[model samples]
Target: MAYKARLQEFSDTLDAEVIDLKKLRKLVFNGCPDSGYRSKCWKLLLSYLPRERKHWKTELEKQRNTYMQFIDEMIIKPGREATEHGGLADVTLDDHPLNPNPDSEWRAYFKDNEMLLQIDKDCRRLCPDFNFFQCASKHPCSRLCGKNSFETLRKRVEQTVLQSESVSRNRLGITNMSAVKRKSSSEFVPLPDGQEAHWEVCERILFVFAKLNTGLGYIQGMNEILGPIYYTFATDPDTECEEFAEADSFFCFTTLMSEIRDNFIKTLDDSQCGIGGLMDQLMSQLKEQDPTLWHKLQEQDLKPQFYAFRWLTLMLSQEFPLPDVIRIWDSLFSQEKCSTFLIKVACAMLLLLKDDLLRGDFPSNMKLVQNFPYSTFDVQKVLKKAVEISR
Candidate 1:
């Protein structure tokens, strides 16, 4: 680490906790170092850190507390009774599920179920091979509530209530929660079947995200997107223990989603900035660099989105192991270009499997591209190829 000039700058200013943004960016252009360096750099890249290092502590606290407030107000409903209908007060007699009122909040609630269910399924299945998402939290977590207890938030979470209709009102008049009451991870008590704790934390984060970003609402595959980020924070290096990984990760995920949300928004799919347009750009780039494969894929009707959509949206999480995904992210975060390197990487991957792809028809090609070509799982090698293509 000391061998790198920018890293040396980071070390020299360790006491002040300041490093040159341009230098830091240049240094990590290839990728950040290990967890301690990567996590900190990620915070900076995501704007979690202010330009003045002195304000880092204050800024981080305020943002993380705000994220907690997001959970307290949005995920957990107040003054609402928990019912069998997913925890909101029953759709009134006129506003019931059968109600014909198109403008009814109850009607809207029911409609949101399709979106919520899709998010739930994806979040639950996110990185199941890992025990962190699969098993349970090491300790039972405390709920986010007011000074005393988050009575409303607790009930809603306990009942899995994600789509309450009174979003505007609840958001406007959120019950005040104390920032000082933030609990350290050490405060948690373990449970026998503690798996619910981690999932619930993830659940609350996504739900809060949906409520806050009404334009995008919750979208499928976001869980996969959030997985590596939370994992990196939660499993930080011992020197830099993260007592509030959940809150910090929430902020980081929000910043990340803001950049990539266009990919998930269906209405924006065809816009110039949308995923579809980017796919067009990617295909064009591939044609410029690897026209043979591009023509072959188009001949077989293997459009970019068929495979690249997941590649771009989840930051390629689904196609690579968690560690490899983290490594790929290091490169993505470093590049100054609009992450076209991701597309270049994908192109390199296909070229790596050019022989097999050329031999197979659409189905085999689809299957091969959908999964990272087993021969190209070495993200390091693929990344090297990706960089050469980018150049």
Candidate 2:
């Protein structure tokens, strides 16, 4: 069937609030270009979609409000000194820095200060190559907040603090890492709260996700995984869809992690189903299908963990271009067995460059594979080759 016809058929089912997964799977695997369709399709594939479509509005309201609540609680003013504590009227003598009580709200807030700093750093650096992640606001010209947003908060905190202590010193006295710093004297400067709306939104989702799943909590590279998902949703042509991207991305990401959580768990790395198992599986397939190349990679001591660990765990999101990464995900989620297909794509990636891989020594081969420019890569060609090997 033609593309529009296929979409029409899908739309009919969608209107009925019942998706035919088998059909949707075929569309996704082949490649979905319609951003609106992809936005919805992704939710379904990741199990973020309700079984009863009638409840979608309710489900969305529940999830989005939950995320907003997280933003309100987990994300707060770095109100410390009276100058900074402008917005936090709730901060009282009980919440002051000197409070040694473990249960003090300030104590708990200060406890994660270091981790928050790290997450802030990583989130800012996410997809730095892409301006979407590098800047705080995509369009700083129309932004409502920036350098002095905190100053406004300070006044609010000061008024609230006035009702209590004359002033409260910053707990941990830590600098706000989220502040936008000027990188150069160039006129084209990004604001401090720079596309902060987006980056900060991603941070809150990760924090909420950590609080929800204490076992895996927040991992270092999670921002990388979350980046593409949010970008895809936030950029959807439909304004309504883009507006709720954060809530949708969170639920989708949570479902995606459920399928692959073992990869992030330290205890499971050595297990057959963990990252080690995945690496072994990839090599095993290479050994069976392309023994010569498999042996060549192993001979150079270019272990799969060195490069493929990130590849598999991140669903190749970091390795491929953003657009290609989405296409790759289209294929990944469409399959009945996602892990099995992922190994095939990885194998196909290796096999496609068999000649370069065949001739190079250890360092040369490692650099070639690890830092290859996937931006210009032809993912369809790789998928074609991947499917051939899978059969």
Candidate 3:
């Protein structure tokens, strides 16, 4: 009975002509019923789509088309052919890869490769316990169908693998050079035509994001953050919404990063808005809520940085499994101030584990917080406790 009542509430909130965002947020604070509801709610919560129902189609089309333009301009390398619309005419002699000029596109492309490599590494290993990211998407990037010249990131990775003969490494402060025979070119298999793996889509979105935001380009744990958002949208039941999940995910992620970019910027680490400041806020909440636990942590020198750094920065994505992370995000995104409320959630986690935390010393408590006991964890209880702490 309660479930049906909650379902009706969400249906009413979402079905309204112009959504009452406050009502929607309150309903979503508990978590969406399924991916279908979650998909629409996340887009609305992230401010990717406006509240007006009539404008949804136009807004989606406009933003999606703009995203494709970004892919065309940024992802695809320009050819040597002269086109009617500024091709060779725009090229300068100093624009080659070896050119010392800072403005060279080739130079920027190479730098982007370095960032792409890191993004690929992190994304490939994303949520190892779950096979969702590894599975091929039912609805791939159909928008990229005709652009055969454009290289998918998977192909780029295979090409890189085939080209590299060996890599140098340092072991125990000693330079070790060894011949590493990587897989042959023939060993690599390609995905079926018109189909790309889910991780590839994630990699492409992050790459585009890094290109657009040059200031704080491609931080490592961003893959963890993007994983849940992409999963929610990509798994959406609406075929139309699922089809353009990539573009939608990109815009939503961009909006989200704008709010948390300060956390990723090192220069602003100690600033009030950065991750350091966020952890400090978490510690303060801990002290106020459970002084004994907080003081014991202080006595054992269990700094928040040792554990809460990843929690606060990644919004607790690392501490929990994918499903729990999504549920937690439901609560976090629904709030007016997600980051500020995250401090309360962190406090809630400590208060729930107060007995263990207060009894243990530094090493045990550190390990406990670093690798959360997800096996017995309850997402709803933690969130309910988080609300209590907030009050």
Q: What's the lDDT for all of these models?
A: 0.65, 0.70, 0.79
Cα RMSD of all models vs. native, in order, equals 10.2, 8.6, 4.6
Model 2 Cα lDDT, one tens digit per residue, 37-129: 888778888887775688888888887777655544454544332234433453445456667778665675565554555555456556757
Inter-residue clash pairs, candidate 3 = none
Q: How many residue pairs clash in each candidate?
A: 2, 14, 0
Per residue, candidate 3 scores C-alpha lDDT tens digits across 169-224 of 32111122234445654323446778777888898899999989888888878887
lDDT for residue 132 in candidate 2, whole number 0-100: 69
Candidate 2 lDDT (Cα, whole model)?
Answer: 0.70
| Of candidates 2 and 1, the better by lDDT | 2
Please report, as a residue range, the 10-residue window in candidate 3 with the lowest summed lDDT: 169-178
Against the true structure, candidate 3 reaches a TM-score of 0.89
What would the TM-scores of all predictions be? 0.77, 0.80, 0.89
* Candidate whose TM-score is highest: 3
Candidate 2: deviation at residue 263, Å?
A: 1.4
Q: Can you tell me which runs of candidate 3 are displaced by over 4 Å?
A: 78-101, 142-145, 162-190
Off-target runs (Cα >4 Å) in candidate 1 are 1-17, 78-116, 138-148, 151-196, 238-241, 336-338
TM-score order, best first, reads: 3, 2, 1
Candidate 1 per-residue lDDT over residues 320-350, each given as its tens digit? 8888888888777765543567788777787
